[model samples]
Target: MYISILCFGIFSCQDLNLEPKGMLGGPELFGNEYGVKKYFAAIYNALPIEDFLYYGTNSNNAYRPDNYWEAGKNSLGNMSGEFFNTWVQVDNDGFAYWPYDRIRDINVFIQSFPEYQVNYTAEVYNNLLGEAHFLRAFFYFGLAKRYGGVPIIKEAQDPLAPVETLEVPRNSEYDTWKFIYEDLTFAMENMSTDIDETGRANKYVAAALLSRTMLYAGSIAKYSQYLGFQGEAATSAGMAGIDASKADEFFQYCVDAGKVVETGPYALYTRGYPDKAKNFADLFLDAESSESIFIKSYDITAPGNNRLRHSYDALMCPQPDMSSFVGAESYPPLDFMELYDMPAIVNPDGTPVRFDHRGDIRNGMEPRARGTMYFDGDVLRGKAFDIQRGIYKNFDVLASDADQGSPNAPINNPNNRILGGRGWTTEINGTTLNITGAHGNFEDQGGENNGWGSAFIRKYVDPDRATSDVREYRSDQHWVVFRLGEIYLNTAEALYELGSRDEAFNYIEKIRERAGATITRPALDQSTSNIGTINKANYPYSIEKSLQFIRDERARELYGENHWWWDLRRWRTADQVLNQFRHRVLSSYYVADEGKYIYLDEINRINRSWTASKQCYYEPIPWGEIGKNRNLLPQNPLY
Candidate 1:
């Protein structure tokens, strides 16, 4: 039967128009399980989680007509100063997201759901109803975080409603959070404990989001008042600020939500393949693993959905076959590397890792760090990463000047820049000795990129997906939206804020044990928690000191994963952390000679304005929305 299926899809507006032949209206559509499933699928497709297929902003629609190479990694990492991307935009479009039309779609689904004449089982109907409520809350949470105190629109409004009637004012920040919490609370109460699909949300998913969102609210309530500029917009409508009085109340909510997930089945990935490095690397690769509480699974085998594949394999993967054959740039910096503590040389009692001599960068370090990043002679799976960016004249000889001696000293051999395009740097007698095929550089004749940092990123790359024949294949490794490890961290952070300092250290130990720390969870307590080998340096018993280590641990654990930028922002330390990244110093260890270490100094990476404006907390509401409706003003405080 040739039938037109008029179903709900991810669009900028709400449309309820269906074609005539075997047409399914609300009663017919929601009454059947098959129709209901297809409708919500479109809603799920519109989620703003930056997954495998999400290629963000490209160039200003000019010379590079279809370049979708910007958002996915470079901007995220560069802003955090973990890795330096070749693509740099200083004052770029800062967090431009205003999906009110999509918000309306979610509202329409929720409002119309109860009225549908459903013949399906009550269980099926309720699950869909729970999902609608959860999705609506999730969408609002996204809006509130970016643009604070957004209008609380619950029921679907008429398209032809009067402009004045539609002009709802922005709610208070506290009230907005309460609104999100109430909806999520309803979802937790009503949603199914289990979902058949891998990517579908359950009670655990709601709890994870609830835990994260409450933590954000707690931070805003406690820390924001000290830094934000107070004005008429801030006072008139609760635009950019939160009520400081509700700090502990929201914190308790965070703690309770995290505890709910803690009692759930999720846990840090312990049993796996090889060593600590391989275990950490494969955690992201294994889609079936229990560590992932919520995932956004991608399917390359979907016939027409092949266009959903991304160029992440091309951009983030440093090797030739891995990079989908283009944009093989970006490298990790030294300031980032220091965050990883050495279990070997550094004692549990805040002692420095003993160096054999001067400039031994790799002697004592976390296996997780080596797992996340490339070091000299580092091998991943079966492939060895030969990061020989710093060349030596002889086997016995190390370069006297590894640093850029002069601004005009020239970056090693500029001819070697074009990968295999320029062959053999030096010659003895008549024969040429070619040191070719560098790990970080990939060249297709004219197009070549050399690694800016000393090492290549090794976290998310699935060795199996680096197909020699199919360079365009987007890796289907499921991104962990909320994992057990992060929940543990969330629990610890919330507890720490609530004055349970001893209990906070207790929870952090589990994450340390998973990272192969010298000190295990059993060994750590308030008495023996002096174990600094897993931490940066000297785990002082103070809450402030412990908080710093938690931040360091988050960066080490989630380096390429990158929730650290938002974490820092929540903690009110963006200016403090990001300002330090203005100058990045990377160290290179020769693969041929492990002892011969070289420094690539003076790499300034960060681009942030240090002015302490609380408006930085919330993204600017798009002017288009304000021009149409008068109530979205004073337009997010400073915007």
Candidate 2:
């Protein structure tokens, strides 16, 4: 059932009637294992909503860098406005009440479990208990990540209880993480390694979460080692609490967790359908692959249809007469793509090998270059492109705007100015091309210029689902949280940090092998293309260089599946990546008297607004939360 959005604000009023009062305590459910299982399923269902993979990037909404707060782009009403303000206290409508709700359900389930004495067995009892602990840890982890410290609500709340008495003091971030780790440890020890369903949290799933948690703690501690805690410091939250020593420990934890799966039943989902495409790409797009440790299963017969696919089509579908595909919101900034060094000669190998020259790597992989997207008429997976808008007006709102605003005359009635049309200018085979779409010269019905960012992101769009309205298919696609490949990268990164270049390379090479890509080995011969013949100036040689290299590899390998943003933030490259690309494109667009692009020079001259804002790294804490719980919540400096 579609859970009511009302669940989000259930905590706002003490006398709220929305509480699930009798559901757990009712005689119908209090005495049955079926009731407990169904209740547990509901908790699992709640997970995909806002807790994990909420698509938190507001930039994906209205083609702007930050669209989540815009009243027009979202349905969250005034809460959308709070998105930009750090003082707002709105919790995630889908998630804020989860762990608390689930914890209560679990408590009731455990207490009433004795009623099913006839069916009680050691295996059944152990599984339920294990699931409870794992879920508890999962909920706590979410709290720790969002708020530094949160109350560990272990039991159901009384409906008649006073709100003031119920309110608990905040826990330290350190304590919260420590608690989550310990809880997960218990979960791992008690829970069986197996789960028949796709969505339920399993041992491996818990391990994945631990890897991420450890990574976050380690990275934050490492980065924050030198800086004294204060107001906002970096452009992203990943940069705020970085301590190098902490980072080391986090990486170690991540690697350690990975080892469990490395040598166990869990292996990389490498075996693809021999009937279909035998490529690794097949493994990712195809749902049946064995490598998928956990997935959010969506059945068309029951709560089916992929929301991701639908979102993709809705946002990117092309406008009439535009020739291209659709709205390109969340365009991959140029700076991020530059991280992948372009190979000298294009190799179809899925793996991204090392580049001879770092500078050349930047040049080869520009989104404007054919190497980035179109490789001789086929949509190459490795390359990226500007958002495509169709030529027809019926398909997109932004396209109509562009048609009316045209100087050619007979300006048509533009529907919604911000809705569609026009594309960004990108390079194709080294030649600059204007990939116009809704954002370019589009005039809205209000006669105002309508459009957002110039670049469009094509990563999430399912090529198979492309249609008139881009949102043709709501793909209930399974998002990969952890995989064998990530484990390898984690190990390699941690090893590199530990000053084990040789060992790290071994791990890095394993990843390359899995991707079926070219591997660059240390030069053993003077073959000009070989490592031996290459000039030392052209290649990276140090441990630090290897760390950076592997990280970049991860970027290209996992571009659209939702990992790069976090990686960029962790590497302290968000501003560097985002701003650099913005400048690069702007500069490329504006040409001067001598035919030289002057956009870069102009942007730098106007106001280094983007650059300066890098100091506002982590997203500001919701102001509303702070107002309600002043004792617990703290702002993340300079909203």
Candidate 3:
């Protein structure tokens, strides 16, 4: 009675006649509602949702794949330069993520689910079918973003069929997006609005997916030509880039999807009330927050399932203090910190701004920045973060005198600038004072467990987990897949792109107000520039200054949420943005003579830089898959 399942891996040409060992029969597994849920569980587990457990490496572990303790160190943030780390660099050539096996499963479900209609109510039957479509759209989205025009295999192919019939040609980039749009549209229409299952897709969740995917498609249609790949075979074949004429069509789809989500029972989370920083931080931790549209739940109790638990807390916080395992592998670079409304580190006179306490740097900063990163005095697990770079014995010169912590700077000489490893001290006037703080900037230490930058990522780190329990694979914080805040940003960006500038700012203003930004709304500036101010990236296309501001707001709000890398790719600016992009650090120095603290901008001690080639925009359709099906040629541009 057991059904034989043919396991496939991205169009593998190998034909092996093997026996099915442990198979679940369709009659027993897909005949009823509970059985259908059970059947869908395996498909859900293989989703390409990049969450905390995602490992950004040149392996198969890119999509929600688990490497346990190393996941945090190999996170997309580290690879994307969103969070500075010594371990990982820009994985320019992606990890060849092909999820045809999962796609096949969804296809099977879609084709076979109708047979079970006799066992359920009409609503339940339609809902399950709609859910299947939603899952397929998600898989397609993962593929379309990475490979452009992938082969759209809607029906489950019979392995026993003729080879010619089984081999499907690749679809055009526009058609691929249109297919996803259609699938999501059907899902939104047929899926019930009342289903409350956690982590399961409902009608609103389908709309969120539509909103995200269409936004991506719109961006590609509008910006892909800027990459100048028109002469390439893939571009000419309409496989790698979408036509600019189709931009408005996809943008309008995104706008419509956003409107659909707005009709759902979702709102921006604001439970923490007056303390906007705490409110922003709590939004991620609160599983029941109204802002969360769709979440991928994790459970620490699921011991055997590595994807169910993550090591975020252990690898993000300093060891023996904030974590019980290897401490703090990643730190927030000062380049990103300055994006928020920050207190000036240097005065008009060009000297470092002296502060009464080291924590004064947080005084005028945006609440969202504080919420996203842990500062010097920020407390976690009842212990305050003690982060100081070093002390200046007699610093009485312009901040530039240090020359971005240059070794040849006269003021930076070892005799004057005191720096040390963890717990190292100096004797000044018979009083021994610790040179560096307990948490970081250990001059003699490597970047592995030492804090390289000024702050630690605080967005998804579980504050409630005790230090004793913060070991490898012991943390369980749900990854917010689709949230109302992100939806708002998506809507705003699409609105702006569609020429509805005033309506776009309405959403931006709401997000900034919640983040406690000093300027809730800034006047629009239509001045166009090809070079961005943030990274000074020389983009191929000119963009409005106001548009860049909107993009920056997305970064500020969604920091460490695995969106920056994708954002850069879709904007066709990855290569320019990451061109020898060296991260900067904010070093806290205590002036010995003045007895005050000063924060100075300095290059990361290791001087590590991130670089992405044009090839990064679209990962080459995995060579193996191309070998199996020649139709996947002429591989992605600049492969």
lDDT of every model, 2 decimals: 0.60, 0.43, 0.87
Top-lDDT candidate index: 3
Steric overlap count per candidate: 2, 77, 0
Worst 10 residues of 1 by lDDT: 1-10
lDDT of 3 by residue, 1-639 (tens): 011142242123123333344444455566888878877787887788878878876767676555557888888889999989898999878888888878877787787677777988989899999999999999999999988998999888898998877767889999999999999999999999984799999999999999999999999999998888999999999999999999999999999999999999998888998999999999999988999998999898886655788888888889888899888899898878999988899999999998998888999898999899999899999999988888889888999999998878999999989999999999877878789889869978787678786788899888989999988888888999999888999999999999999899999998998899965455788889898755678988999988998999999999999999999999999999899999889999888888899998999988899999998988888888877888778888887
lDDT of 3: 0.87
In angstroms, give how far residue 288 of model 1 lies from its true place: 0.8
Judge candidate 1 at residue 10 and give its lDDT. 18
TM-score of each model, paired residue for residue: 0.81, 0.63, 0.96
User: Which residue pairs of candidate 3 clash?
Assistant: none
Q: Model 3, residue 548: what's the lDDT? A: 92
Ranking of all predicted structures according to lDDT, beginning with the best and ending with the worst: 3, 1, 2
- The model with the greater TM-score, 2 or 3, is 3
Q: Runs in model 2 with CA error above 4 Å? A: 1-33, 48-119, 157-165, 230-249, 271-280, 299-309, 314-330, 343-376, 379-460, 466-473, 498-501, 521-543, 570-623, 626-630, 633-639
